[model samples]
Target: MMNSLDISEECNNAFDKILKTRRSIRFFRDEIPPKELIEDIINAGLFAPYAGLAVENKEYFRKFIVIPRNTRAMEKIVEITKNIMKVKSEAFKSEMDKNPYLKKKGAAFSKRLELFADKGVLGIGTAPYYIVIAEKRGFPPVQQQSLAHCLENMWLKATSLNLGFHLVSATAQMAEDEDFSRILGIKSGEYEINGCAIGYPKENPSESSRPETKEVINWIK
Candidate 1:
């Protein structure tokens, strides 16, 4: 019979496999994942790290908005995201002009910003579902950190289920947009938001490379 040590080793190995297999999947099949499966992933997100004492509302602190592909809602969000990226791109350009070294070193990033400002991300509508996860702003203002934890949990859950996942990071900057804020039924700046796309992949991409554990880990005595 397997002992407790054997069970612990098995669990650790399973989790390691899940972590190593996670990838940022951009292209996806058109088929929509079952509603229950999506809920399971979102449910995983709720269990992530949160500042329980920071917010008074225990019942409705975090929110998730799920939109299907090719819908009017998706259209509005895509347009809003593009506009926000445009503002971000312009701000970066202004900074680049002010600093000669910044302009030189930021050339590649500027190109990426231009792409976002112009066309937005194709994965927004390519995936069967676009999910916006919003965290309620609190006194300490650690909402973004909480949202990051929430997303990582959801991403890992999706990976374990063989679903594709992509981060729509521009959604974080749209909190102050009047039109986008209205869609969430919250006042501007009331929430810190992040978004992601999830669905089955069209083709499996290889896992991303990572530095050796010894290369990055630091120990303090």
Candidate 2:
């Protein structure tokens, strides 16, 4: 029979596995996650800890916009993203001309952009669902930290649900474009923090490299 300590250790191990196994999947199968699952994931964000005693009154601080598969909106997003990539590629090349150190990196980046434009190789593929996480404009640093906490919770929830999750930062550039924001129905004075794509994975992604804990952490005491 297992003791309470053993049960506690088991729980810790399980949580560790979840953290280790969560990968940012770029490709996904064309299946839409169920409505209930999406709700559960959003609820996980809702329950995340926020700053200030007025937490109950701060619902407006965070918002989630969901885009389902193959809709006109999704197509618009994909097109806009492609245009943004093109602009980024040009900017990368211009910077490479001024900085020799960036030449190698810029070449690789431009190659990827070519694949994305010509071969349809997306950094974040056409996942069945996309959730745009937005925050009210002019939030202070603490509240912004709270927004990040909310996203981390949603990511963990997606991992626990056996779904592929990819955070799409490229969309933030699109959010800045006034026309694009209008298409997405984001009014003025709101900032798009980032986006998350969710779907069944096309393949299991390999583990990414990470720096050793000792390299990144220090103990003063």
For every model shown, what is its TM-score relative to the native structure? 0.88, 0.75
Using alpha carbons, what is the TM-score of model 2?
A: 0.75
Error of 2 at 2 (Å): 22
Tens digit of lDDT per residue, candidate 2, span 1-221?
76646667678888887788788887888777898998899999888886654344565667788888678877776776677678777777788899988986668777776665554434344788888777665534454566677778888888889888887655555556765677667874466456788888889866556899899988899
Clash pairs detected, candidate 1:
none
lDDT of 1 by residue, 70-135 (tens): 899888878887888898899999999999998889988888888988998666666899888888
lDDT of 2: 0.73
lDDT (0-100) at residue 162 of candidate 2?
86
